[model samples]
Target chain A: MMTQFVIRRVLYMIPTLIAVSIVTFLVIQAPPGDYLTTVVARLEAEGQYVDRGQLDALRERYGLDESVWVQYWRWITGIVLHGDFGQSLVYSAPVSDVIQERLGLTILLSVTTLAFVWAVAIPIGMYSAVRRYSVGDYAATFVGFIGLAIPNFLIALILLYVSYRYLGQSVGGLFSPEFVDARWNLGKVLDLLAHLWIPVVIIGTAGTAGMIRVVRANLLDELNRPYVVTARAKGLPERRLLIKYPSRIAASPIVSTVGWLLPSLISAEIIVSVVLSLPTTGPVMLRALESQDMYLAGSFLLVLSVLTVVGTLISDILLARLDPRIRYGRR
Target chain B: MVESPPPLLDVRDLRTHFATDTGMVTAVDGASFSVPRGKTVCVVGESGCGKSVTGRSILRIVDAPGRVVGGSILWDRDGTGDPVDLATLDPGGPDIRKIRGDEIAMVFQEPMTSLSPVHTIGSQIAESVRLHTDLDDDAVRGRVIEVLGQVGMPRPESRYDAYTFQLSGGMRQRAMIAMALVCHPRLLIADEPTTALDVTTQAQILRLMVQLQAEMDMSVLFITHDMGVVAQIADEVVVMYLGTVVETGPTEQIFTDPRHPYTRALLQAIPRFGQRRAGRALSIIPGSVPDPYRRPGGCPFHPRCAQARPGTCDVVEPATVTVAERRDVRCVLAAEEVHS
Candidate 1:
């Protein structure tokens, strides 16, 4: 039954992704002119005569001279058959290669942030809910509120300044200047880990705070449920009782929020990466959109939309696994 | 010759209170009762009369803002070992923990919400069994299946993997009873276990419980507001009014020779076929239970008590009087009325 449901859902993703690609292409083309216009304007601003022949050849080479529908069809077909995402107007490389260069770092940052948020927030939230008005609970709530209120970019900026001022070391980028372009190695990995904390902390603060509130509120509601009382009456140990019933139910809502997490995290990363100077897709996508790098920008948007849909699907499956009411069918 | 064992549970001077933001609300005030081995004691009261609180005090599962302020719940383990005071045991201590589901289990009122929806029936039942015994997985599953079959559940083997949501209300209640009885607890505290079921299902559940009690020889603390249920199942009945046990006696005696005014009103309150006056409305107790925070100074029920006297009943709380062996009433006029 579960396998069939998964297959059905996976099949549904094809049309959803196709529709997303169409809408993304249209929206990316919605703004006036193409990448060549910006290049021509820059050259003209530099007092050079407009290179009409060069512009026409460049446009044809990049398929910018084709209609929007034709361009979309070519781009999508390339993605389907040849695993290409068209050419990047800005980077002069394939869009797929540009994204591939940074996808690893983006996933690493997101996964680490996810791990930090869940590890710290869930426990604190559970404690806050159980203890309620205790000093520890109050302190945690106070810290959570502060975390939620501060913007991620401001947080990134402050951390960068603090590290530079107090520690006398650069906190920018994912590696030191010496290893910035170096090949993969143990030292480079260690350096990457060392620099990963600042961005991770800044991006993770808001999520941790939000998740803490989610778990806290949901747990507090579940604690009063009759099943919890029943579990206690059965003399199940406190911790086991929590894990078996209330916490599991309370985690469902948090799991559903996973669909939105990646999108929000990516959006937040754009601003934070610009401020912190990390070489992730966030700043690249931001610059690509601003410069009308349609293929580059469109590919990034497609990746994001795919992540959103896949995240939602994953959350749905997890929720069904965690809660039988949603899994089997509505009673 | 062995002396007859003491009662299975001896609760004396029980007072459970909730320290609310407004004030301290005394829920169960000076409730004293005992549950004999192999018998059912039904605590009959309205919604706020604190019968449920009394049940929770026995298990030490009262949530925050509520506590057993004064009580001695002497649980006679095996009816031979020294009685352990449940109220005095630490709420989460191992001693009480062992006694809670091992010696005394509880089946709550709402079967729908009582068993967790996420867990399978076998797992939930096995939890109680596993906590009380050193049973391995196979042993626990076997015990769960046995108890499920004993509770008359259909297809016990297949039902083992079924979640609570899949079970109907009646089946869920049966599953709850099965979970409570998996360990063969010495005392089962069923707080209105059948109130949420249909009439026919309620009869079936009550019958199942009685059969299981006889087989296991365990005492039962049945809490309910329905006197009809009390009459059907209770070997002894404890009638509570405004958090106080106004009268307690054998089920027949409480029904036939109720002494306290509250008890009389409660018996009269039950609508009997062919007994009502044709033109008159059904009899209802004039007033509701008073707010717990602002309990009347004297007899808490005096404001609504028909037998209340002007200065005496309104100004002074009544003292409990022993009318006969194992029979008691909390009323100022009991002695005068009994003598007359």
Candidate 2:
């Protein structure tokens, strides 16, 4: 059943991704001028405008002089046929190559942050809910509210200051100066991990806090339900009763939110990455959008949209596996 | 001389109170009853008369702000020795916990919400079996299927893996009863187990419970507000009014010669088959149950009783009087031994 559901989801994503690509392409090209105008303006500013013929030749070579529809058609056909994402006008390289350089670092950071958030949020939320109004619950609730109130970037700035002042270390970027452009070796990976903690912790705070509130509320409601009472009356121990019954039910909504979290985390990373100067796709995507590099920005947005769709598909499959009501189409 | 064996459960003056924000509300005030082996004792009352609270108190499943304040719940496990006072034991202590689902299981009122929606019915019943007995996985599955079949669930093997929401209301309740009976508990506390189901389902469930009780030789403490249901299943009847037991007798006597005014009112309130009712409104006990915190000083039902004497009934609470062997009534008109 699950395999069939997953296969159907995969097939459905084909048309969805096509629609997403078209919308992304149109929105990128909807702006006033193409990347060629910006390139020509830079050349003219540097006193290097040779002739109008040369400019037209450059536009034709890049296929920018064609209609917006023709350019989208050519770009999509190239993508489908040869696994190409076209050229990045901003970086003067292929869009796939540019994305390849930064995608690994962004995925690492986001996944690490997500893991950190869930690891810390679920237990604390369970504790606060089960022992609600106790001293520990009140203290955890206070800290959670503070975590929610403080912005991620502001937390990043504070961590930076604390590290600089007390620890005497410059913690910007994903790697230290020595390993900045190093090859893929053990030392470089270790250094990357050492510097990875700050971004993960800073980016994870708001998400963890929000998740705590959601889990606590959901669990509190579930704990009062008749099923929970029945479990208790069954002579099941406290912890087992909690984890096996209400917690499993409460986790459905939390799992369903996974689809939205990926894109939102990437967007949040854009702002925080710019502040921390991390070598991730966040700042690169921002720069592409700012300079109107259509292929670069559109390719990044397309990947994000695909991730959103895939994330939702994964969450749905997981929810189906976890909840029999949804799995059997009873709900 | 031959003496009778002890009852399975003897609840004496069991008072369960809730400390609400407004004040302390006494839900079960001096509720005393006993369930003999292989017999069904039904506690009948209106919505707020504390029937369900009594059931929950027996199982020690009352939530926050509500507790069994004062009483002795003497549970005679095997009828061979002295009874253990359940009220004195900690609610979650190992002794009570072992006895809760193993020896005294409870089936809640709303089977729609009683079983967890995410878990399969087999696992739920298997949980109780595993908790009470040290059975292997195969043995537990065998017990679960056996109980399901006993409860008249169709296709027990296939239905074992069905979720609660997938089953109809009657099936869910059957699954609930199966879950309760998997351990072969000595006493089953069924709190309105069929109230939320349709008439046909209700009859089936009640009949199933009676059949199971006889087959297992397990006593039952049945709580319900429906007198018709009481007539169908109860061997003995205890009528409650405002947290107090107003009458206790055989089911036949309670139906025929009710001594307490409240019991009489409750029996009359049941719409009979051939009763002529051309233009009269339905017979009802006038005035709802009073605020638990501000209960009137005399008989709790005096305000609504047609035979109430103003000076005596309004001034003094009625004392329980023995009308006959194994029959009692709390009414001033029946007897005149006021101790308080």
Candidate 3:
């Protein structure tokens, strides 16, 4: 029954994605700038273009000389079947290759952040709400408020400074000094982690604070729910009440929102990745935009959207399985 | 009739209050009651009368900002008649949680919210069993099927694995009962257990509870606003008003020859079939429960008591004068009315 529903949903996503690709192609084309002209003109200035025949042949090959509708149709068809996102105007690489190379870095960072966020925030939030006005709860709330106030990039800069001055080491730039000499092994991994600690802590601190507040508020509300009180009356142990009831109900909404959590993750990474000069998607996207690297930039955007949609879809499926009320069509 | 033993739960002078930003609000103010083994005691009152708070206070599940300032919840572990004061025990203390499910289990209202929507009912019920026992998987599964059958759920073998949402309201209530009584707890605290069910389901659930109690010889502390339910199941009745136990006695005596005016007024409020308060609406108690923040210094129910003497009733909190064996009422007029 559940599998049928998921299969149906996956089938439905096909047309929606086709529509998204068409929209992506048109929007990029309709914007009054033609990036291909600049590349061609720059090459011409360097005495690369010989005559009208050569220029026209080059334009036809990339589909720039064709009608806008024809070019769009060709691109759409390529994406739908062959999964070809087209070649880059500036970087001159296939769009998928660009996405492939950068996606791992972004996922590595975000997933790590996700783990730290939940682990630290849940306890802080639970105890804070449970304690309500105790010194610890208030202190945690105050710290969370600091994360809300300070911009993440500014925090990143401060962490970098701390690593350089206090620790007398350059850490925020990814891999430590040893990895510069050594290769990818146990020692290199440990060295990278040590140096990455400052940025991870800074970025993670703010992320953790946000999650802590979210978990705290959600948990507090769930605790006051009549069901929670009922669980208490049943003479269930404190451990049972917390783990079984409040945790699940309180977490549902946040869990449902995970698919959409990427924008914040990407935006947060932009500054941190830039400041540290990490070869992540944020920096790649920025450089692609500056150089009018159309294929790379477009490919990055497509990958991001797919990741978000897929994430949300996964969350929905899991939620349906966890909850009987979700109606996964028990057939 | 086979007489039951002494009360399983003996609460005395239960004073609970919240030290909120707005000074102190008395929640379960100086209330007292007893629930004998193998029987039901229904605590009935309007909302804000501290009926629910009294039940939670016994379990020490009162969330922060609300504390059990002073009280005694003397609970008997078995037929030994030795009562343990639960009010003095720390909420996180080992002794309390250890006995919570094994000896005393609670069935919360609204099976939907009480049962985790994420898990199967069998898994949830198994939690109570696993917490205090060392049963293997097959043993736990066998026990789950047995309890489901005991609660009168149809095809218990198949339904134990279902989640709360898959079951009907009546079935959910039974599942909740199954969860609470699965361990065969000596005492069960049922707070508004049937309020969420339909009339037919309520009757069935109540009867099932009574049957289970007789079979297991367990004590039940049933809290509800429905006097009809109270009349049906309760062996003893406690009438609460403004955080105080206004009247408490055997159910038959309290219903038939209600001594306290509040009890009389409450019974009178219960709708009859026809021609009973002819062409008149239910006689409201004239006023709502007093605000705990601005409570009367004397008898808390004086403002709403129809027979209250203006000066005297409003000036002094009456002592719980004994009217019969195991029957006491915290009302000055009980004696006066009896003599009259």
Model 2 residue runs over 4 Å out of place are A49-67, B276-281, B337-340
**Each candidate's DockQ:** 0.81, 0.77, 0.53
TM-score of the first chain in candidate 3 relative to the native first chain: 0.87
DockQ of 1: 0.81
Local accuracy of candidate 1 as per-residue lDDT tens digits, A208-299: 99899989999999998999998898888888888878999899999998889988887888888899889999999988988888778888
Q: Please report how far candidate 3 places residue B97 from its true position, in Å.
A: 1.5
Per-residue lDDT of candidate 2, residues B1-340 (tens digit): 5676888899899999999889999999998878888899999998999998888998888987799999999999999759999998888778888988899999999987888888899999999988988889999999899999999999999998888888999999999999999888999999999999999999999999999999999999999999999999999998998888899999999999888888989988988655565655669888888877898878988988999999999899888888886688999978853333
Ranking by TM-score: 1, 2, 3
Candidate 3 chain A weakest ten by summed lDDT: A322-331
Residue B76 CA error for candidate 3 (Å)? 2.4
- Residues B139-195 of candidate 3: C-alpha lDDT, one tens digit per residue: 998998999999898999889778777889999989889988888888888999999
- Which rank order by DockQ, best down to worst? 1, 2, 3
User: B52-168, model 1: which lDDT tens digit per residue?
Assistant: 989999999988888988979998877675888988988877788888788899999999888888989888888888888898999889989999999999999999999988889
The predicted structure with the larger DockQ, 2 or 3, is: 2
Candidate 1 docking category? high
- C-alpha displacement of B83 in model 2, angstroms? 1.5
lDDT of each: 0.88, 0.89, 0.79
Collision pairs in model 2: none
